[model samples]
Target: MKILLLLLTVSVVMAQAQAPHIDSSYSDGQIQAFLKDGFERNDRLLQAKAYYLLAAREQNGGINNEYTITYLQKSHELFAASRDAYHLHRAKLALALSYVDQKTFDQAFDLQREALTYFEQRNDLFMATHAAASLANTYKLMGNLPQERVYLERCETNNKLLKDNILSLAILNSKVVNFQRQRQYDQALSAAHQLLTIARASKKTNFEIAGLFFEGILHQFKGQYQTAIGKLFDCLSLISNPNLSPEAMQCYLHLSQCYEALHDYPHAYQYSQRYGQASHAILNNQRQTALQRQTLRFDAEGKRRQIANLEKEKREAEQTALWQRTITIGIGIAAFVLFCALFSVLYFHRQKTRSDQIIENQKEEIKQKEINELRQELTLQNVQAIVTGQETERERIAKDLHDSLGGMLSTVRLRFDALKTGQPTHAYEQALDMLDNTIREVRHIAHNLQPDALLQFGLTAAINDLVNRTHSPATPDINFQTYGQEFALTPTQSLTIFRIIQELLYNAIKHAKASEILVQLNWQTPSLMILVEDDGVGYDTTQIQTGMGTKNIQTRVAYLNAHLEVQSVPDEGTTVVVTVGV
Candidate 1:
């Protein structure tokens, strides 16, 4: 009987091991069947192996975090209970990964450290190095740069000790990320080049793609946009699963940024849209996984309850049979009790089904809401871009009017004065009068479009002129104040800021009907702050619509890459503040 039990256990273990195929193409149904079979066998090693396989498969399939963590936890417990050191460490490592996926960095780090310690104690250099690498990754995620570097160094040391180039390649990959995070571009580039060379030497497609992606990122950081684009495209071309792979998503994002940097706005927008879609898809997948996890947990609990009740019924029936062996009525009573138990089970099962259906409906509603929100956000961004473009064109037209039309008119006036003698014809005098009026109008229009003071004399003079011009007997008592030293700014920055101030003043006068307005400009060496305040009937900010003037102000603020704050309340004065890097 002992030999037979040993043989049966071995068979079960082997069967469990063979159940979940390692092939990437294996179906989820097959994996579920294997897990069910192994679990039903109730052998420790077999169950542990089955759990590990399920975790691995779920991870590869991008299934929800709960299931992965559940399987890993189960596997860890079984492996530890069975005293299987090798498999226990594997289970711990897998558990650490699940923790990482769930962003539980502290837990991940602890588990990885335990695995590392175990491997080192066993002199398992290969797994020890891998564990060290994982620890490094967890540290990176935790934003502990120094600690990350420390573990990475340890990983390199072990890899070198093992004389394993492939293991060392992983170290190099981590170095690229580490150096990139530190903004050590030269070091990052060198590491990426080395990684590419090694990956090519290994002739591994995935590693090669990863190397290219890293190189692309390094080039992008170095401002070699075109070269970065080339490398990223090469990486993309080799990517088999763009939606599922983090690297591919990163590639899409980097490509978008690279195109934007190159001034290829159309392509940039296209890639950016793709990046957004891919990100949304990933998030949706995570949400679905979370929901699935909840469903699974519910189902498991329901099964446990069913099993417990059934066991109780069986015990009761056995007791009844013992008491009623001589009485046939006792058999009837047991049968009736069993029927009642079955009915209760069925009723509870129906309730569980209804609950599941409700949860699924809620999940669907949340998913739809998220999708709609994402769509609306994308639409807003697109509209904002168009508005920005329109503002840019207005600035350009204003500059053209000031430089070309205004200059031409001034030239003509100069010629007319030169040609004038002691007496002038009535038509020539009328023409001169018309010309004067036209010149004034042209100047006014040009100033409205793009302020000359902003372009020529910088922000301080421009703002002072704006306040002075806007202040009159009929208008608000506008006060202009300046603090700190005035500094030079790029034309684009100056115009954007000027436009923002103009919009704020215009809004205050037209909408707020203010009695007094204060405009303040403060220039600290590397930054500028603009404050505009008005004592007027302020409207509710939440009720403010995205009108052209408001949109223009927003566009200009964005163009300057500045922070804008608008505070207003009914019956309270409005205040607008802007801050920008100088």
Candidate 2:
């Protein structure tokens, strides 16, 4: 009995491992119709198969596992009652998978063993290999390394017997994972390399990527930071499916750690941030998907109830018509007229209900849009706060240098001049000149940190001063213009605008190599507009890499609830326009 149980358990595991992929192209309505047709035909086998397919579809759609379990149970019953051992085993295997999902490991193990026995009796080496692999995974999950190793070896041996290199490669991949878990890096690396070679030769992109990921992990464990980074990046470039999010998340996290170990704090921080954002996005997407699936299931259930009620009403009408037929002609005419009136009333009520439903749906859509807008607003506000904090810090630093450091330097120069009373020597003149240059350089640095003109004279004068400073015979000819009525703005708004203009000018001069630049600030009654144009060799905006300057500009613009437009064509001038409600 124990041997039989073990065999059954194996069969169940294999069945789950070999579950067919659900084709998402088919609509839920079509699947339901197919199932209904099978049931109406009273073909038990067909009904069982249909139910199994439905379960698979539900599983793939990420619907509640209980729904899948219900379908699988029905399929299993039908197959068992029909005494179709082969199909019954398949049903059992599917049921085991559902049980596994529900964390009923004992039941799953029992079903898997049964499935294995069935496959072995039929001399099905491929399925037997799949069963062994599943068993290995189960053991791994249970933390029974010895048992896991035994099954993994069995899986590989069976794959070899079947003469399937792809199956063998899969087993090898699993072994690599097991080896990694055991901290046997050498074995893991060896297996990963073999898997990669086979996967590449077979043109299996997914397996090849997986192989690359394993290689990266092995290298990371060996403290080969550079090699690991390259391998991990390669894996990331090849991953397109959201299902591989966990792998991608690991890559990002490990890359962050590797960079940190190498004392590259900036790269480390960047990767860590990427990992956090990716993880949040993945979780959000999963939550939304699950909610959508639940909504769809509820809708389907409501439709089914409506259909059942309609059928019930139709049956009653048929019976009433039969009774009416037996009545006299006069009564029959009256009955027919009464029926027409009742039908009209029912139709009118249905139409009214449908209209109400439509209105409700529209309301829900509008509410969802409002919620999304609020979320975006909150995100922008957070970014604005960060930018504000950074600017405030810069201002503080500038103030310190201007007041404390500048004052001390000036006092030092005064003392030096007072001490040099006697000799008008060459050394004294050179020392005076050096001291003057140092003071000028310090002032320039302080001004750049938080421009004094921007704080004292507001946005227009600051922009004008900036234009004049950037204007040189060797540099581009920058033109500044103002239009509309000049209006007052809060200091924060003025500062943000000034910084944006500064970045734009810097980009034009340094990157674009412009010969001519125009800066315009227009303040109307309720709005403010700024435009910066440069006659320079532009770039492909789509391919433009967003640097710190661009990011800062984006943050400030979002904070101001503004619109920004940039038009750039290769070999032509670039124009950037920003409009904000005052």
| Candidate number achieving the greatest TM-score relative to the actual structure | 2
Model 1, 1-582: lDDT tens digits are: 111111111122223335442323334445454555554554567667766776775665556468679878988998888898888887888788788878988788788888899989999876777687777777787788778889878877776667765665667777888889999999888988888898789876766887899889889989999999999999998988888777778888999999899899999999899888889888898899779877766665564355345446656766877677747777788998999988998899999999999999999999999999998787767755765676688778878887899899999999998887765688789989999989988888777876767767788888888887777688988888999998888775676788788889988888888888898998998999999999899888888788989987886777566899999887889999999986
Winner by lDDT: 2
Q: Tell me each candidate's TM-score.
A: 0.41, 0.46
Mind sharing the TM-score for model 1?
A: 0.41
Worst 10 residues of 1 by lDDT: 1-10
RMSD of each: 31.9, 31.5
Model 2, runs deviating above 4 Å: 1-41, 240-246, 300-582
* Residues 185-290 of candidate 2: C-alpha lDDT, one tens digit per residue: 9999999999899989998887788899999989999999899999999989888963338778888898999899899999999999888988988898889887
lDDT of 2 at 514: 86
lDDT, each prediction: 0.77, 0.79
